[model samples]
Target: MFRPGRLQTAPNVWKRALSNFESRITRHETSSDDKKDLILTILSSTATKREARNYLSKYPLLKENDIYQSHRRILDSDVVSQTSKHDKLINDLLLKHSARSEIQLPEPPQKPEIQLSDTLRVALIRIPTPRRLDPETLRGIALTLRKLVQLGVSPVLVLDGKHQIAAGESRLLTVNDFVHQCDTLIQALQTENLQARTVRGLFEQENFSLPELLVVPLLHGIIPIIFPTTVKKDSTEVVMTPFETLKCLVSNLCGFNEAYRRNNANDLLTVEKIIYLEDLGGIPSLERFQSSHVYINLLQEYDDIISELYIGHLDSSVRDVHVQNLTEMNQLLAIQPAATGLITTPAIATLRHGTRTTNPIIYNILTDRPTISSSLPVNLKKTPQLNTTVIRRGTPLTIHLSDDQPDGKGIDLLEFDRQKVIDLNKLTHLINDSFGKTLDLEHYLNRVNGNIAAIIIAGDYEGGAIVTWESAGGRRVPYLDKFAVLRKLQGIPGIADIVFKSLLLTYSDELLWRSRKNNPVNKWYFDRSTSDYCIPNTCWRLFFSGSRVRTLDDLKGYVDVCSKIEPSFV
Candidate 1:
């Protein structure tokens, strides 16, 4: 069907066109349209399909071709099935026309690489309603569908309305029908494709396998669907998330959800007291809510001085109000349980409720609020007093993890646990001495129960630290949850140093913790730390030891998680 003589005369035509095109360019005497048409004509007359393909590849402007027509003519000739030579020429022409053009085009996409395994990869197609579908959107969706088909992905489409056509042996079903049987869509597709070869053979026998003459109507307000020719298999790896980690996250989210749901009050208080003499103020707004009733009862206990302090005196000047209220409030907060309980009640409650959930939304809600211990007491007794001096020189002090309850030869070292039942009052007293006030005991317990190895207590509980495993960038490492020493025992030579050394030696791995940026103890922490960084606009300074932080991306994940935690110590 390919005439060799007709092709052989192409060189003469190309030479004439080349000379004319060059003359037009040199003289600037021809329009761009005329020059392009002339070059296209010369290229079409090439001596062979190879020459035409090579010529088009080199110039890359003359792109149109009648390769499909040529292919059809060859297959319909007396030499049909023996027309490999003609077929090759038509394929080459088609490839050249499709591959080379004035406009640059990317390479044709290939199907996703998949192993020839027995496992199946599920594909889902979300069907959209036709009432509001646009022509341009339909075209884009069709193109994506074609790509999916080319990749051997036969997605099970969910139809929403009645359909009239039969796509070979494929069946259409209503939304309700599909929804009821939706779980079986993958099995159906796999079964259908598995028998594709047999169905194709039947069609060939019935004389319907050949290309047929049919008019393709313009596609509009319709979804394009593609069926698979054969069953497809793809390889995938599965991973399981830790239950403890998920539980922790959900608890945090639930606490915040409850906080917002229970209280609609703003964070600022109705009344604030500032004292220049003491350089102190009443507890934070959340604390005020927690202790409102307690503070009112305390005012009645000290009723003798109420009139002098203008307690409930509405007509007093703003200056008088500040002078009187500030002094009384400061004195009330100085009392042991009252000040400590006010600050720690909500934190402990929130932590307790937080243990019941691990949702990401709850985690996000919790992080939006300030952590419990971001601020410190303006006044703390510097001269420490010990209730008992039990340790002697060279006393073998061992650090052991507490297993749910305190157990060891020196369990008495943790004085707060002497009551046997670890309750809120004991924890409050413990924190009031160690930190300036009490902390959220429930939140601390949850962290301990979920991820922590144990509570590391020193001899007779002179000092201790909460230790846990935390994941960052998928790598789990040791994290220090809380560290505290009895106020009186602090600054004693070898008291804290031995506990620190023993714990570090025991884990022998990377440890991470955050300290308040301006805390006096940070100087000691920084001296022993391998690395430390102060976060902007926050009071926290993250510290790490035993390993080098790797990439900035890795550091970012660690920072984001740690920064979101409320101050764990008061």
Candidate 2:
């Protein structure tokens, strides 16, 4: 309920009140005595109307509107003038206070004196190839000289054309001269004071030559002028002759080759190395050069490096020396022509596990090979009889309920039997109809088991369901895709595996058996070992048990019975 507009107007009202008060104070200061008395008399009148009229008459120059108008004008004018005066007054007060204060003005900084020492002079004269002297070494010598001076070692210095001493002349000669002059004048004071040391004898030495000298010192005052290499002084670029560049290239290549050999035995030679060796004029082509080779032939001297070097000396030479292209050479090594006789084909394997047996049957189908292998060992009590009837390569294998038992019932009993065969496409449709509409066909197909006798998929059976299938026969197959799918389903909370398992069980039973009398003897049957066969009570628990099934050992015992049934008969 706060009004923003009223809050904003409050500042303007306060500003007007301040301006009016300022105007009134200014009028009180400037008004004549008679005008002031008349105004005061008017204000002291009893009636409000009479007071107003009397006040206006006394200030006759001001109209009824002029009083208010002039008040504002004068206030505004005073504000501008007072602001300027206030700033000036503040500045004057600061200057006056600063003058009275005892704080001293800081002295201007003096340039440092450049005084040379004996050690530095000796070091400079000893250095050979003075122009190529290292900057770091020169700086180090300078620092050593400074330290020696601080230790009170006075030395004489020589100079060039400048009046400034080139060497340590000031410390050794000037200071000593002043001390001697002072000693003569203040002999009485010296008797009771500490004696000043004389550097006269130290400066008189003439044999200052140092052994093994290569650099000559150029003295400028007491300062030593040092000539150092360009690299030490920020800039290092040099224009090299073709021969020099070739030499550097050869040296670098030799180092690289040695490093490569030490690290790896399979180091391949590159064109750059070949060019470097060629420029050294040591070898022609190490091997016979083939014309069809697309890689740059350093021996032929037709590559970019040689071309650029040639063009560099042309009428209009290239400015940038670093420009070089080796893309063609790189491409030659990177690419290869497709080879013939490389066969490509789609191949897949399917595996299925039965109760009791740890091993299962595996079937592989492809353009090159179509076969099935069973892990049931020859020495086992029973084995699955495989249908030897060969089908053409690439033909899809089919499995379904036998036609003798129509209506999709009794299908589970004949599952292991070869009484019926339906293609993968038909089984996919059956699963879709039996499960909820949310079941994805493509996902299910991709999750089909390829490994024999291994859990293919596992998850909550309801919203997030898992279906595990293994290939027939003991064949090694990749089951990661199936496992990934099952993991995805398991991530959904609250969904249990029993829902899907029960649905599959119901579908299998309905599809396998046509009627009660049609139940096959070796067919899968639900024996109520436990009281509750409902999903949550039995099937759910069994599916979610993962590898910890309590009835697994019992299930294995029934494998012999399942094996007795003929492969073709349900």
Number of the predicted model whose lDDT against the real structure is largest? 1
Q: Which regions of candidate 1 are displaced past 4 Å?
A: 1-392, 395-398, 401-428, 568-570
lDDT for predicted candidate 2 compared with the true structure: 0.24
User: What TM-score goes with each of the models?
Assistant: 0.28, 0.12
TM-score of 1: 0.28
Residue-level lDDT of model 2, residues 1-570, one tens digit each, is 769998899899999988878766665343333234324433433224533543233222222112223544554443211122123423443464464333222221121212222112111111111122243433332332332222222211111111112233543353333344333323321232212121111111121111101111111112122111012123332222222222332333334334545855632111111111010111111111210111122222234334444443423322121122122222221221110000111011111111121110011110101121111121223323321211111111121222334443222322332344323333333334333233454444333322112121112111222222222133211111111222233322112222323223323221111112232311222221111112221212111111223254333322222222122111
Positional deviation of residue 382's Cα in model 1 after best superposition, in angstroms: 29
Clashes of 1: 13
Per-prediction RMSD in angstroms?
A: 29.6, 40.0
Candidate 1 Cα RMSD after full superposition onto the native fold (Å): 29.6
lDDT of each: 0.36, 0.24
lDDT of 1 at 143: 36
Predicted structure with the largest TM-score when compared to the true one: 1
The lDDT of model 1 is: 0.36
Residue 474 lDDT (model 1): 80
Off by over 4 Å in 2: 1-422, 436-438, 452-570
